[model samples]
Target: MTLLTVRRDGEIAVVTLDNPPVNAISEAVRKGLYEMVGHLDADPEVKAVVLICAGRTFLAGADVSEFGKPPVEPHLPDVVDRIEAAEKPWVAAIHGAALGGGFEIAMGCRFRVAVESAKVGLPEVTLGVIPGASGTVRTPRLAGVEAAVDLVTGGRPMSAGRALKTGLIDAVVSDLESDAVAFARKALGADLPVPASKRPLDQMPEEFWQAALKSASKAGHQAPLRALDSLRFATENGFAEAMAHERETFLDLRGSEEAAALRHVFFAERAAPKPAALKGVEPRPFRTVGVIGGGTMGAGIAGACREAGMEIILIERDAEAVARGLDNMGKIFDGAVKRGKLTQEGRAERMAGVRGSTDYAELAQVDLVIEAVFEEIGVKRAVFAALGRVCRSDAVLATNTSYLDPRAIAEGLPNPERFIGLHFFSPAHIMKLLEIVPTPDTAPDVLATGFALGRALNKVPVRAGICEGFIGNRILKRYRAEAEALVIQGVPIAEIDAAMRDYGFRMGPFEAQDLGGLDIAFLQREGARAAGQEVPETLGDTLVRAGRKGQKTAGGWYDYAEGDRTPQPSAAVTELLAGWTAGSLDLPRTEIAERLVGAMAAEGQAILDEGIAQTPQDIDLVEVHGYGFPRWKGGPMFATGAS
Candidate 1:
C-alpha cells in the first residue's frame, strides 16, 4: 500500500502516512520519509509540510517485526536527520501515540502539534534499550534534562496536555489536519524554532544526576539506568557525541539477554488477549455482569468489571453478606480515589452503577455471571447450580476457582457449553494475569468470550486446559517445592530468599508465602489428603500443624515481631524440621536460583507435553504476570529454553 502521499492546501503541503494498524516506522516508511524530504525541498510551491498519519495513529514506534534483524538502508536516525535538514519546515500533527522512534521523528520537525487526547514519549527503556534515534539528545533540548531523564527512564507516555506543559509539543488543537495546516501557514514567514539537535541542552546539578541514576536503577534491569546515562551525557557533551553514545547503548542492549527476554514477554503479551485458535470465533458481547460472593476476590472482580464500564450485579447469600460485599467494593473504589486513579465524583458515578442483591434471581438479565465463592467444590457447584436456574440460557457463567477441577464444578450445571473457568489472581482488579480454562464441552464462542472479557479488563489471558492446578499454580507448586527442597538440604532460608531477590523477584518464595499465609496452600493439600489421596506432607504443612501460619500469626517459616512483616529465621522451625534436614551444606547462590528456575521449567515442560498449556510463551506469561516471575528474565520456560 501507499505509505506516504502529499496533498496541497495552498502553499502548505500536507504529508500523510498510511501504514495501517499502528503506523510503525518500518524500513520502507523510513525511506519514504527520507525521500519525501528531498521531494518537498525541491518544490518551491510547497512552502511548508504538515506531517500526519492515516488509520489509527501517527507513527507509534519502530517496526517491532524488524527487531533482532540486520539494519536496512536509510536507517531511522538518518531519515529523521534528513527531515530536520530539509529546506522546507515541517509541522508534526500527532494523534494517538507518537512513541520511541516516532517521537524522535517528531522532534526532528520544526514544530509539533497534537490533539488534546494524543500522547508522546520515548518508551525504549521498556523494550530493554535506550532511544537510539536522538530521543535522549533532542528531548532534553526540547524540554529540560530532568524531564528527559524522567520521560526516557520511566518509559511511560505523557498526554498531549502534559507534553505541552513540558515544552514537548507546540499546541493541542481539536482539528488535527486543518489546524496543523493553518499552524504551518502562520509559521511560514515567522522565525522557526531552533532545531532540537542544535539547541543547547539544559544542564542539571551533579547531585541531581546522582539521584536520577539511583532512582533509575532497578534490580536485574539495566536499560533504565543506561537511559539516564544517555540523557546525562547529552547535557555534558555535544549533541552528536551524545547521539552516538545513545546509539551504541541501544545496539549493545539490543543483543543482550535482558532485551531478548523483554521482547519475548512483549510479543507474548501482545498475542495473549486473542489467541490463534479463537481467531474466527465471535465472542458473545457482555455488558452487565453478575458476581457471586462479596469477599476479596469477588469484590475485585466486580470492581474490575465496573472499571471496564460494565454494570455490576454483586450477589451474596444473605442481606448482611450483600452489605459487606458492597462495602468491599466500596473499599476498592476508595483505594482508587486515594491513588488519584479515579475522582470522588467519578467513583460515585461508577458505584451508582453497581447493584448488590442476595437473590440469584437478580442475575436473570446479566450477560455474564462469575462465581468467586469459596474454593470448595461443593460450594462452587452450588453457586453454579443457582446461576443455572436463574440466568438466561445464553448468559455465560464462569467459575473463579484457582485449583478445583472446572469440569467437576460444571458437572451438574445446565448448558455446559456456556460455562467456563476464569481463574483470576487475587485482587483481580490489580493483577494482570487471567487464566482462561475451557472444559471439553465449552463452546468456541464461550471460550472467545472469556478472552474478550480479559481484553475488556486489560488482562493477560492465557488459555489453560483442565489440570489440577492449571498452568500458573502448577508451576508455582513446583517452584515452592524446589525452594523447600533446598531448605531441606540445609541451605539457609534467608540465603535462598536473598538469592531469589537477587534474581529479581520482589520477594523470595518462602517470604511471599509468609506474607500471603501458609494455610492457604496447606488447606488445599489437606483437602486432598482427606479425599483419600496419597499426599506427602510439606514443610508448610508441618508449620501449619504447629499453629504457625505465617505473618498473620507472627510466625511461619520465619518469625514476625508484632506488626513487622520482615521475616527473621525461626530457631523453633529449624528444630521442627530436624527430622528431614541434612547436614549443613553451602552452595553458590547462582546454583540455588538455577535449581529453582530449572524445576519450574521442568514442570512447565510437563504441562506443555500434557497439553495443559498451549505454548512456551503462555507459560512464561502466566509465571510473569500471576506469580511474580521477574519480567526482565522472561519466564522460567524462556530463561531455560525448555519445551
Candidate 2:
C-alpha cells in the first residue's frame, strides 16, 4: 500500500499518512506528500488541505532505520519547506505523538488541530541533535522563545492541552481527522493566521535569555546547548537564516561522538529487556505487590511501584518500623512534589496506593511479592519461604539481593520456577537500571514478569543469569579491584580520581565508593568471609574497619573537613599506607586509567564467557547506566573491544 494518500472532499482535500506504528517521515512518504500538495494546489477544487495520520500515532519522527546511510531525494527539510510555501493552506490533525520532525511538519501547517490526547514537540535533543527543518525557527515564531527553547531543548512532548496553551496548536478537538477537516473549512472562510515561518519572535527580558543559555550550558550535554543557540538565533536572525542554521546545526551534530554515543544508548535501551529464551512468552498480569522490607531499598522499590500506579503493601518487623518505612515512602513523594517533579495530586494518588503491614499473611492477596530486605542469603531465603506459603502458587517471588545466588535462595521454595531476582540499584526509584536475574529453572512467564515490572516502573531491564553481583556489580568488582591495585602500587588516590575524570567517568572509583559509603563494601566482604569464601581485600575495607566509613562519617579514602567534602589527601591515610610498606610502582594517570578499564573489560569478557550475562551490549548497558561508565565510550565492552 502507498504510504500517503489524498482524498478531495469538495473544497478541502484530506491527506492521510498510512504508515504503520508511528508514521515516520520517510523518503516515500515525503515524496508522496510533496506530490499530493502540488496536485491539490493546482486542482482549484481544493481550497485547503488537511494532513492527518493513521495507525497508532502521527508522524513520530524520522525513519531512524536510514541513519548513517546515503541521503535520498525529498528529504524531510525539503518536504517541510514545500509545506511552508504551499499556496493552499494546510491543516495538521495531530494525534498520539508528533515529535521531532513530526512536530516540525505540524508546525509547517497553517492551522493545526489535535485530539485531546495528542502530544507534540521537537524531541531531537534526546537523540543528540537539534530540530532540523525549521522546527526551531517556526516553533519560536508561533510559541514564543521560552516555550520554543523548552520544547526543543528539554525534548519532552507537550500534551495537546499544553500545546494549545503554548499556541503550538489552534485547538484541541474530539474527532481528530473530521474536526481538522471542519477546522480547514472554517479557517478558509475567515482571515487566516500567518504561516508559522512568517510569525515574529516574542521579545524576552535580558535575564530570561541569560537564564536559558545558562540552563543549557549547565546541562553538560552538547545537543541542548546547540538547541538553545538555534532558538536564540531565531530571535536575532531572519526566519530563513535561522532555519538554515537549524538544518546546519542538526547535520553538524548528527555525526558527533556525543550523538553517536546517545544513539548507541537509544538502541541499546530498546533491545536490552528482551532475553533469548523468553522471546515468545507473555508476562503474567499483576496488580497489588508486596514489598518485604521498609528500609531504604524497600521504600524506594515500593515508591517506584506506587508511582507506576500499582497497589503496594510494605512489610516490616513491627508497627514502628512499618510506619518508618511508609514514612520514608511518603518523604520521597513529598520531595518529588517540592522539587516540582510531582503534582500534589500525583503524590496523593501514589501515597494512597501504598499501605503498611507487619503481617506476612497480609501478602496473601498480592499478585507479586518482592523481598527487598537485607541482602543476606539466609534472610532472603526465609522471606521467600514465608512468601512461598502466603503468596499464590503462580505469583512471582522475587529477591532484591544484589550479589547472592538467587537459585540457592529458592532451594526451599515449593515452586522454584516463580522465584527470580529483581535486582534494583540503590535509590531504586530514581535509578533507571533494573537487572532481571532469573535462575536456570525460572518459568518463562515468570522471567517475563520481571521485565514487565521493569517496564511498568519505567526502568531499563537486562536479563541476567544466576551469579553473584549479576552483570553490573560483577564487572564493578573488577573495576574496584583494579583501582585498589593502583593505590597499592603507590598511585595517589587523588591522582587516580583525576585520571578517571579525564577519561569521562563522572567520578573515580574511590570517590564513588566514599559517596556510596565505604561500610557497604566492608559488610559485603565480611559477609563473604564469614561464609568461608575468600574475598579480595581492598583499601576501603581497612578504612571502614578504622571507623572511616566515608562521607556519612566525614571521611574515607580522603579527608572531608568541617563543611567541606572536597576530598583532600589525608595525612592519616598517607601515614597508614606508608607504615603498611606497600610496593612502589609510579604509574602515569593515562596508564592507570587503561589498566583499570582493561581489568573491567576482562571481567566482562569472563562474564560473557561464563554465560553470566547474555550479551556484550548487556554488559555495556549495565556499566553505562548503572555504574556511570561514560556513555560516550559506549560502555566498557565496546570501549575495550570485548563486545
Candidate 3:
C-alpha cells in the first residue's frame, strides 16, 4: 500500500521529498507529491500529513535545467494546488533554504515549522522571474507588503527568527521532523492551522507604501519595480487574481533577452574555472601564516587569515607601523561585533590569533608568507628576495599585487617555484574573490595550496595566468579607458555614470573613481604613458592637477558637499572637459554610454580570444566578484554574448 514509503503513526503520516542536494522541484518530485497527497487525503488511518524533504535543505528552488522547456504534464504548480486544497491538515517541515517555487510549495501547506537555522526566500527575481507559483501573492500576506517588496526585490534570504517575526512560519523547532510530526498530530485534533489563502492582505499605512515605492524608484533597478508592481497587484486584488497577474508577468520577463542573458551568466559562474588542474593535487595544511606590510591590504589580509582560524604574524617596517596595523585590525573586529555578525567572545578569539612584529626572523617558521607591501616592483622583489633567504625552502611566498607581474617579482628568489600571486580584493575578509595568479615556474603544489587557502578563507579562488594586470584589472583597464574616451567626446561624467547604473551596475565608472580617489588611477596612467602607450584623455588628470583628489578632499570629477556622500556635477570638471573637446567631435551623452558598453564588451571578447581568461564565465566571475558588477545582468561578456 506504499507509493513512496507511507509510514503512519496513529493518525499522522510523514511524507518526505526524497530528493538529494537542494531537493529541486522536478517533474518526478511533483508527481510523487501529488500521488502521496491524494493517498493521504483518501486514507482513513491518516488524519493529517507532514511534508518534509530528506536533505540538508527543504527545497533549494526549481530545477534550473528544466527552465525554458515546455511544461511537463502535472506541473509543480498543479501539484501544489492539490496539496493546498486537500481536506486533511498538511504541515511543511523546513530546514536549510526554501526558495522560489519551494517557498511557494510551503505556502500551500496548512502549517509550517522550521529549524532555528532554516532560511526562506522567494528569490525568483534573481532569475528574471517573479515567483510564478503564488509566492508573490502569499508571502506579502504573511510578511507585510514592504518586507515582501524588500526580500523579493533584493532576492535576499531571511533567517528563522526573521521568518517567525514576519509570520511566515508557525514555529521555529529544534527538531524539524519530530516537532513537525507532533504539530501535525495536534493540528488534526484541534482546528486547522491558518491557511495562507485565508490570511488577510498586508496593509501598510498610506504614507509608508508611498515612501517605499518612491525609495524603490530611486534605486532605478527594473527588477525592484517589477516586484513592487506584483505586490501592488496582490494588495489590490485577491490571491487568485494576483497569482494570475504574476503568471503573466513571469511569462513576459522569461521571454526577455535580458533574462536569458542573466540565466546564462548564472550557469557560467558555476562553470567559471575548471577544477581539472586541482585533481590529484593535495593542498598543504596551513596552521600559521606571516603577512608582511601594515597598510590597508596587509591589515585586510591579516583579518582574512585570522577569520580562517589561522594564527597570523603581522610584520611591518617598524614598531609604530605594526601598532597602527593592529589598531586598525581591532577597529574592524569591533565593527563586526557591533553589527551582530560576531559575539564579543568570538571577536576576541579571532583577534587572539593575530600577533604583530617588526623583525624578519619572526616569519622563519610560518607555513606561508603573503607580502602586501607597496605596489612598487623593486620593493616587492626585495621582499621576496629576503623571504627566500630567511623562510623555509618549502614555504609558499605570495605577493598580493593587483597588477604587477608575479614572474618578475619572483626572478631573484632562491625558490621561484614556491612564489605566486594571491590577489585578495580590498577588505579581503569581506570580498569573495581571490585571483590566484601562477607564473610559468610556479609549482603545481603551490597552486593547489593557494586554492586550498582561498577555500579556507571562504573565498572564490580563480586561477589567472600572469599578465600586465591579470584578469579583472586587465579588463577593468579597458572599461576605464572607454569611460575616459566618452568624457573626451563631450559626455558629462554624471550622465555616463547614471546610464551604467540604469544598466544594472552598482555604481558608474566616475562615481567609483570619485569614491576610490582620482589619484589612485594617476600612477597607472603615468606608467602607461611612460611606456609610450597612448593615454586616454581623462578628466581625472584635470581634477588631480586642481588638487581635487576625491571624497577625501570633497572634489574630483564630482563635488561632495560637507556631510554629504551624494555626488553633484562639478562645474570645474565640466568646463575642463568642454575646453579639451571644443575643437574635437561633440558626442551625445547616450552615445558615450553606448560606446562604453561596446568597448567593455569588446575588450572582454578580446581577453577570451587571447586566452587570458579560460572562458566567458571566468571573465564574468572576475567582474562579479572582483568588481561590484551586478549579478542580475550577468557579467560584461555574458551581457554582450562575447563568449
Candidate 4:
C-alpha cells in the first residue's frame, strides 16, 4: 500500500532518506522522495511527515559527480519544491552536517530540528557555485541578510547553537529524528503551519545594508560584495527571480579561471600523499611524549602534542627558560579561551596533560622524544646519543631541525631506523602542514607512525626527502631572493609589496619581511654565509643594517608610529637603495611585480623538474597552507598554470 515505507506511529510518518555516507541528493533519492510525498499527501492517515537521513550526516550536498553532466529528469530542486508545497506539515531532522543543497532541502521544509552536535551551512561558494536551489533567497529570509551573506560568501559552517540563534533552525533537539517527528505531529494537530515560502521577507534597513557594504569593502576583495548583491536581489525581487539570478551568477563565476583554480586547490589539498611504501604498517601508540629544549619551536611543538591529548614533558637547560616556555604556552591557551575556541574546562584539561622537566631521565618511559634543541649538528647528535641510551628501544626519536640531515643525526643511535624528522611550522598548533623527513635507514613502520601521528594532530603530513629546508622553505628562499634582487636594482620595497598584493598575494614580499622581522632572515643568511654558502644580499640585509628590524623596532622598509601599524616608505632606505645600485638600469614597479611572479613560477617548475616535489599540486598545497597564498586563486602553480 506504500510506495515509500510508511511506518506510521500516530500522526507522524518518518520519511528517511536511505543514502550512505553523506546522503547526497542523487536522482534516485529525488524520485523516491517525490513519489513518497505523493503517497503521504493522498493518505488521510498521515497528518505530518518528518524528513530525516540515514548516515553519519544528514546530507552533505549535491552529488558533485552530476556536475557538468546532463540534468536528471526530475532534479533535486523539483523535489524540494514538492516538499515545500506539501499540504501536510513537515519537519527536517538534521544531524552531523547539512550543507549546500542539503541545507536548501531543509529550508524548503516548514521547520528544521538539529542535534546539538550538528553543523549547517551553504558551502557552495567553496565549490565555485552559489546555492542554485532557493538557498540564496530563503536563508536570508530566515536569518538576516548580513548573516546569510557572511555564511554563503565565506562558505564557513556554523554550530547548532549559532544556527538556532540566527534562526536558521527552529529548535536544537537531543534526539533529532524523534524530536522532529514529535514537533511535526504537534504542528499538525494544532493548526496548519505556514510554509517557508509564505513567510514574509525579513527586510534589512537601508542604513544596515550600506553599513554592511562598507564593512565588507574594508574586509577587502570582490566575493563579499558579490554575496551582498545576490542577497539584495533575493530581498528586493521574488524567489523565482533570485533563483534565476543565482544560477546566472553561479554559471558566470564557475567558468572563471579563479574559480577553476580554487577548485583545483580544494582537490589538491585532499591529494596530500600517504606513501604506499608505508601501507599496512602499524604506528606505535604513544601516551606520553618528551620534548628536549624549551625554545620557541620546542615549546610550540610541545603545545601541539598536548593539544592532541598526549602527555608532554618539556625539558630545558635551566629553570628560567622552562618558566618562560610554560608562561608562553599558558598565554597561548588563554588566548584560545578568549577567542571562544576552547572552553575553560577544555583548556584546563589540555594544560594538565603537559609537564615541564629539567632532567633527561624523565624521558625514559616516554614513547616518542622530539629534540627541538639548537640546530647545531653536534648538539642534535649528542642528544640522540643520550636518548638512544636512556629511552626505550622501541620509542621513536624525532628532530625538529629545518634543514639538517636526519641520517647524520641518527649516525650513532642504537636503532637508526627509529629516528626521523617531524618538522613543525612556527606556532606549531596553528599551522596545518608538517614536513615528515625520513632517511634511507628509517624503517617503513617508523615513517608510517609519523604520518599517523600527524593525522591524529590534524596536520597534513607531506613526505619530504633529506634536503636543505625540505620543500616549502627551500622554494621560499628562491622566491624571496628574487624579490630582494629587485630591491637592489632600484625598485622600492613598498612598490614590490604593492605589486604582489595587487597580484593576489595576501601581503607583499617586503611587507611580509617586515612582519616576520628582519632579524630571522638576517641571522639565517649569516649562518648560510658562514657555511661558505653564497648569501644573497637582498633588501632584508640593508634594512637590518640600518637598525630597521620590523614592527618591533617601529621601522623596517617602512616607518611605524604608536597606534599605527601602517608602513610608510622610508626616504633614507630609498636613498640607500639608489646608491647601492647606481649603475643598474631602473625598472618600473609593475615590471618588478611581474618578475616576482615569474620567479616564483620558474622556481616552482624547477623544483618539479628536479623531482624534489612529487607534483605541482604539492607545491601549490605548500604555498596555500604554509605561505598564505590566496585560497580563491588557488596555489601559485595552479594560479599561473605552471604545471
lDDT: which candidate is best? 1
* Cα lDDT of model 1 by residue, 197-222, tens digit: 89876678889988887888763599
Candidate 2 residue pairs in clash (backbone atoms < 3 Å): none
For candidate 2, write residues 431-461 as lDDT tens digits.
9999998888888899899988988998999
Identify the runs in model 4 with alpha carbons over 4 angstroms from their true place.
Answer: 1-6, 67-73, 217-221, 273-279, 536-539, 542-546, 562-564, 582-592
Q: Rate the local accuracy (lDDT) of all candidates.
A: 0.92, 0.85, 0.81, 0.79
Among all windows of 10 consecutive residues in model 3, the one with the lowest summed lDDT is 581-590
Between prediction 2 and prediction 4, the one with superior lDDT is 2
For TM-score, candidate 2 versus 4, the one ahead is: 2
Off by over 4 Å in 2: 202-210, 341-345, 579-593
lDDT of 2 at 315: 94
Every model: Cα RMSD to truth:
0.9, 2.3, 3.0, 2.9
lDDT of 4 by residue, 1-643 (tens): 1223557778788887767767888777778887877889999988888888876998788875676566675766677788889877678899999998899889888889999999999877676567767777888888877788788877789899999999899899987777888888777667665676666687778998897788655434455566667888888888788877876776677666666776787666665646556768888877799998877778788888888889999888788888887877777788889999899999888888878877789899999999998877889898988898889988999998887778888898898888899988887878988888888888888888898888878887777777777778887788888887776665667777887787667788778877889888788778778889987677678778889898889888788887798999977677766656544445676677678766777877877777767778877777777887777767768767774
The candidate that wins on TM-score is 1
| Clash pairs, model 3 backbone | none
Question: What TM-score does model 3 achieve against the real structure?
Answer: 0.91
Runs of candidate 1 with Cα error greater than 4 angstroms are none
Compared to the true structure, candidate 1 yields what TM-score?
0.99
Model 1, residue 449: distance off in Å is 0.2
